[model samples]
Target: MIRLVTLQSGIAQGLLWAILTIGVYITYRILDFADLTIEGTFPLGAAVTVVLINSGMNPFLATAVAMLAGPLAGLSTGILNTVFKIPGILSGILSMIALYSVNIRIMSDKATVAIAGNSIKKIVATLFPAGTVSNTLSTTVGIIVCAALIATLYWFFGTETGCAIRATGNNSKMSRSMGINTDMMTIIGLMLSNAIVALSGSLIAQFDYGSALVNMGQGTIVIGLASVIIGEVILIHKEHNFAYRLFSVVFGAIVYRTIISVVLTISGFKATDIKIITAIIVAIALSIPVFKEKAAMRKKRNLAMKEGK
Candidate 1:
């Protein structure tokens, strides 16, 4: 029974975090840039939402503000990379490091900030008022929100500007030659990506943890990469359409969280080992394609040897 509850909770959390993974995919996969600002923006969003909620703002509005703040972080990284000519990875690292202090300030110099008002789940329960299960409501909300986000992204990416962004990622030199401002595209992509990430963080802080902590986003990059890689592995042979790939990332997040929940239920799993386990999972997922290619080459070699004999 406890395990069942744990699994359900994991699914709910996974759905929320999938938003962040999708955001990561925008920067890492689509933009071909490793922007580590997500680690900072995640906690920054949580801090902003929690502080606003504690100050009597509407929960939904607070979440929106949190998302709005995300773009600023991304913009900073973009400026550092484009204007100052810093390397992509370094720019992200600088932005992430700076956000630590910013997040602490946002939380009023506290390591954590507890929310004071009703959570979204409770608010939904109030609207229903008919023995609405909090877990089920939360999960339902997560699904609806994720689906809406994915649909919106699909539409946006099909636009002219979106195609230019895609072209910038595929070949920056060619995009520039074709009159696409690669720098502007990078900034826009990063802003959009971090906005989604922060939105996820806000939801997580409000619905799951009930507080925003400074260290809440620790090791987030690994988890996001793991989710993306896991999804790609599962969809290795699927059509490379945008909508399908987005859905695959969400599914990957669910699977990753499910695996973690199951591991935690085992007898000898220590809480501190979670990061190590996540690392192993990500490593294995990333190596799958390489292993497959190597196997294929070996098989080809064997067939050639047999023919020669």
Candidate 2:
């Protein structure tokens, strides 16, 4: 049996990352854009939250401000891509690079900003009787928050504006022909995506680490991509409803974290090997569908030859 504390921690971490992965899913899978600005926006959220909390602001309010900061980052990328006519990938890269400096400025040029008061985990602990497991409470909070977010996204994506955005992603030329403002839809999608990513960063900083580090968001995009791919691979045959897809993304994050925990528990496995392992897992997940298709083609060809014989 998996250890209770370890399981709780893994679930909490997975839930936090699930939020980020959902954001990635919007841009990568929904909008069909490889927006790399998430790498900057994630840390930007953490920086904003830590700065506000250290200034004696309420944690919840600080998190809200952090979420707001995310849209601005996304808008910057949108303007670069839509207004300035830069390529989608390039626009995201430019925005991400600029946000690195912005994040440092937000932290007053400090590489790390620590929260001065009780961490969010401690605050949640107060809600339970003394001696109750903090990880369990935090994980519960994460689950509730994630469920709310997924529900909101599911509803939003079903609306007229949401359909327009989906159409924009599916085919920009077709969307434009249908009188949809494809550029505007793209901007809105990016803004919403980065906002969610920032929100996740803020929550993770407050509830888990109580500190915002400049490099904390490095490799975040990779993890997000990995989660998205893993979820798609696992749920390939399931109904593709928006809510189900969103839930699958969250589940994927949980599975990814659990795998990492299990790997760490193995003898001779070091923490430094995590990125390489994650990359391998992502590569394998991504290749599965291609391999399956190739095998199917070969099988069809063999059947045709046997029938001809």
Please, what are the lDDT tens digits per residue for candidate 2 over residues 52-161? Answer: 98888888888899999999999999999999999999999999999999999999999999888655666778888999765677578779888999999999999999
lDDT score, residue 238, model 1?
Answer: 51
- Tell me the whole-model lDDT of each prediction, alpha carbons only: 0.90, 0.89
| CA deviation > 4 Å runs, candidate 2 | 1-4
Instruction: Tally clashes: model 2.
Output: 0
- The Cα error of candidate 1 at residue 19, in Å, is 0.8
Please estimate how well model 1 matches the true structure, expressed as its whole-model Cα lDDT. Answer: 0.90
Per-residue lDDT over 115-180 for candidate 1, one digit per residue giving the tens place of the 0 to 100 score: 888666667777776886556766877898889889999998999999999999999999999999
Query: What TM-score fits each model?
Result: 0.95, 0.95
